[model samples]
Target: MTEMRYTTLGRTGLDVSRLCLGCMNFGSEQPWMMNDRDASVDLVHEALDAGINFLDTANVYSTGESEEIVGEAVASANRDDLVLATKVYGDMREAPNGGGLSRKHIIDQCEASLDRLGVDYVDLYQLHRWDENTPIEETLAALSYLVESGRVRYIGASTMSAYRLTKALYTSDVEDCSRFVCIQPEYSAVARHEEENMLHVAEGEGLGVIPWSPLAGGFLTGKYEREADPADGTRGAASESVRSYFTDENWAVLDAIRTVADEEDATPAQVALAWLLHQETVTAPIIGPKTSEQLDDDLGALDVSLTEEQVLRIAAPKQPRYPES
Candidate 1:
């Protein structure tokens, strides 16, 4: 390998590989666009062989298909050389008690995640999103219980509002529970929403920031035309979280990114990923691939470096899509 890099997850006592394999693609068959178990297996092995120690998936991913594949892969490796993480909090069932930070839900899902992954414990278990109805204490308490029970090695949170994340960290310290060791936010060259505040808060609190969709919902993948075809494929549909950013204005950023990609003789995907790696607070970028070729293109990011001038050239000026415009 190219002397693959590594970094420590702030205060989590977990040293994670700089490049984390995202298994969200392994989740659903209806989302027939993503990688299936067999295809994902090949890509995961490619990452493992490349010295990637961090693998991120979520219970809600493909309704837990992602976790199943990641779990199976980890077990097959049997080296304990990788740090595995997955999330909970999206509705996994039709019942009222199906999801959220409810003590019952968190605990129930953690065990189910473990079962699906075929592992006794998860390296890091995260709340996929915040639940306003439930007190942060209740959520942290349940997460603490898991760590204390040895079912989870560490805990993190994803998609929490800035205020809620800060509140959770403080609550964990005051209540003597497992705090969020990390925060998963949507960030990338085109998605700079987290930079507004979450990035600073995470860096200050000693919590690692793992950015999901660092590729900007396949916009950074070098495909899709802003004018020619507007309907995003299934991959873009999964990014309902960022549906608002898919606008004509954001296309300007894509155009500039493409220019830089051409200048470097690299794929836009490689340039996009390289953009995120330039940030120090970015512990790792969650990258999902549906094919070995796509996975290889993502890995090529490790080799491409952008100059300071180049980084500034495409830096999103304001909101990707103006709030008013």
Candidate 2:
């Protein structure tokens, strides 16, 4: 971790870790049970010790058990030094008013999230995903109100269309509301769809970009090679969200990435994340470390760098066959 680095979060003037630890796996140990309190605390402490100032979690992760774990971790960490973040706009429950970007649901979820996180405020409060039914103004105004109340320090949006993101920014400017200053997108060596125009919009607008699934949900870790059937219990094999990165084009990209990893004397995971950090517009690569060993390897990306040619060789952008159209 000698060469660990960070990047500024858009116009917020916050310096966040180049790699933000994503906590969606929290309390998801199996059999529909959340992680025990002690193990959760330990993971948070370990990440902080490794200089990971950024942590990303959401209300829907583990059906809110993830938020409880995140809350416990933050209390255990005990600091305003950490750049903690969490998201909303998910189906918090089965109730009609339980979800959406409307003021009622947004505020309700923010309070619930604050309670779950056990914090006075979160560094960055993000909309987990877009909601088209609600007007963008309603969402922005609600977030602005949160800022005014000091419950949320800043605001961000996740996995939104370029059109919506632009509209939100303009609406904020005109209405004097809290604007989204960052974007969270599913980006990886094999999934680079965000690069098409969403990322370009973020850069042009000076909005920070954090890429989720930086390893293509562990497909870039080299643990799921062509010859090796994915580990039986691994998330990728089990997850409906990430099965496609395993396709043929991604396999070619994987081979190219592995070659670079060997040349740099770095782990494939590390090389993959470094490639993400190399992108001019990417502020942070969201990494999910299910265990201490995995966390350590992911953090090692802090010291890895890819040569320009090495970067180009693996950046087969055309691979995300189902483009973000």
Candidate 3:
């Protein structure tokens, strides 16, 4: 197997795989999840065998079963060779202090995640979402403690407004805390909203940009038809949330992507991921495949290069929108 390429995650000296394996679908607790423990373990092994050293998971995925599966999957591998990551700020329990970016929750969840993953430290401990109730300083302070304590090497934020991300970064600087080295956002041909300011902010701030849902929750795979209903077992058919992505404008975007995919003699999924890989600001786009075949197809994106005209054509009409000052 050809080894996947590696890249530096933002300004950090750590090198991570260009294709990060996301373990969201690794466990069966969630109704939409398709992988069981053994299958999840096999996928992780295959990913590592393919030279994908970066792995992303969250505490809330399958209520921590995902982490357990990941833990067993990578237990025998040399820990020092991988860049392990997991997120906090999700409700892991029903208690009042169950979630959010509060100091207590951040610290508590970090330990719990460490326990679940059976690892001493995570390379990147991300704030899954912005916590409005918690002060930025408080969250940063707690995360700083984790870094100082050697429980987390680096920190990242996901899915926050550009303004909010700016504030958090500024507060980390002023407070003399460990700043976020990366940002994970939803970015794809159909979800170009992050390009408006988030991508620019990441570029200017020297933050690594790792995008999730690079295929727009499987919508860019050209599986869902414009007139017909989503097929059974697909993400679009299983969840109303995924169905929301099948908008008229997104269908047009998919049409354009399909045209380009045909011209390039590649699958729409590969072309969609290649679009993200071609981005100068993107460090990597996380690929969460339900099966080994899917993982192989996603990795094929590395070979699908697009011309400048093709890139522009794929992104035409839907310009990034910026907020007014």
Best by lDDT: 3
Over the stretch 102-149, how does candidate 2's per-residue lDDT look in tens digits? 999999888988889888888899998888889988889899999999
Best prediction by TM-score: 3
Clashes of each: 1, 2, 0
lDDT of each: 0.80, 0.83, 0.90
Residues 1-325 of candidate 3: C-alpha lDDT, one tens digit per residue? 4458899999989999998998888888766686678888998999999999999999999899999999999899999999999999999999899989999999989999999999999999999999989999999999999999999999999998999999999999899999999999988888888888788889999999999989878888888997889877778887886788777777888888899999999899999999889899999999989888999999999888899998988888466675411
Better of 1 and 3 by lDDT: 3
Those runs of model 3 whose alpha carbons end farther than 4 Å from true positions after fitting are 322-325
Clashing pairs in 2: 27-34, 27-35
Error of 2 at 105 (Å): 0.5
Candidate 3 yields a Cα-based lDDT of 0.90
- Spell out the clash pairs found in candidate 3: none
RMSD to true structure for each model, in Å: 2.5, 2.0, 1.7
What TM value does model 3 have? 0.97
Q: Candidate 2: where is the Cα deviation over 4 Å?
A: 1-3, 29-37, 317-325
lDDT of 1 by residue, 113-225 (tens): 98998888888898888898898888899999999999999898888567878888889889999888888888888778777667778888888888898887677776676
